[model samples]
Target: MRFFRAAYAVAWKDVLLELRRKETFTAMFFFSLLVLLMFNFTLNLDRTQVLSLAPGLLWLAITFTGVLGLGKGFLAERENECMDGLILSPVPRGAIFLG
Candidate 1:
């Protein structure tokens, strides 16, 4: 229960910070669109080409956007030194890394 609460609190904190800043989602969305466009332009996304490359394109977009989102996800904690606070909370280091 305590672990669950902590997880929920951390998630809620992230959501609230994102709501206030609004830049993370905006940047991620724009970057994803750019990636999609690049895939189309460079790969020549015709039906046959798209069929073959579609999985790669989709996964590439997801991976890139996930990386973007990951960087942005830490924005609030970095700004407010929340990472230090989290570390002091007794959670295992591996859990923090996974988080």
Candidate 2:
């Protein structure tokens, strides 16, 4: 219970910071949109084919965007020295990850 509480606290802090800046959300949105657009232009699929492929394409964009977003989030924390602060805290590594 304590472990979960700490994890929630950490996650909440991360969420609040993200809400304040909105960079991660915007970047992820644009990146995913760009990816989908690239595919749409390149594939030239008929409407039926595009409909069929929608799920796969969406997942592909989501996968790449998620990877980039995680890296960007880590970089933000590192640049602001927050990563070191988190490291010095008593929080378990898993809790930090959950954040």
Highest lDDT, which number? 2
Candidate 1 structure, TM-score to reference: 0.78
Q: What lDDT score is found at residue 49 in candidate 2?
A: 100
TM-score, per-candidate, Cα-based: 0.78, 0.86
Give Cα-based local distance difference scores for all models.
0.79, 0.89
- Candidate 2 per-residue lDDT over residues 1-99, each given as its tens digit: 777988899889877877887878999999999999999999999999999999999999999999988788778888999978888999888888776
The reply for model 2, stretches above 4 Å from the true place, is none
Which stretch of 10 consecutive residues in model 1 shows the poorest summed lDDT? Answer: 90-99
RMSD of each: 2.3, 1.5
Q: Which segments of candidate 1 are over 4 A away from where they belong?
A: 90-99
Which window of ten consecutive residues has the lowest lDDT sum in model 2?
Answer: 14-23
For model 1, how does the per-residue alpha-carbon lDDT over 16-40 read when each residue is reduced to its tens digit? Answer: 8778877788888899999998888
Q: Pick by TM-score: which candidate is best?
A: 2
**Model 2: number of clashes?**
0
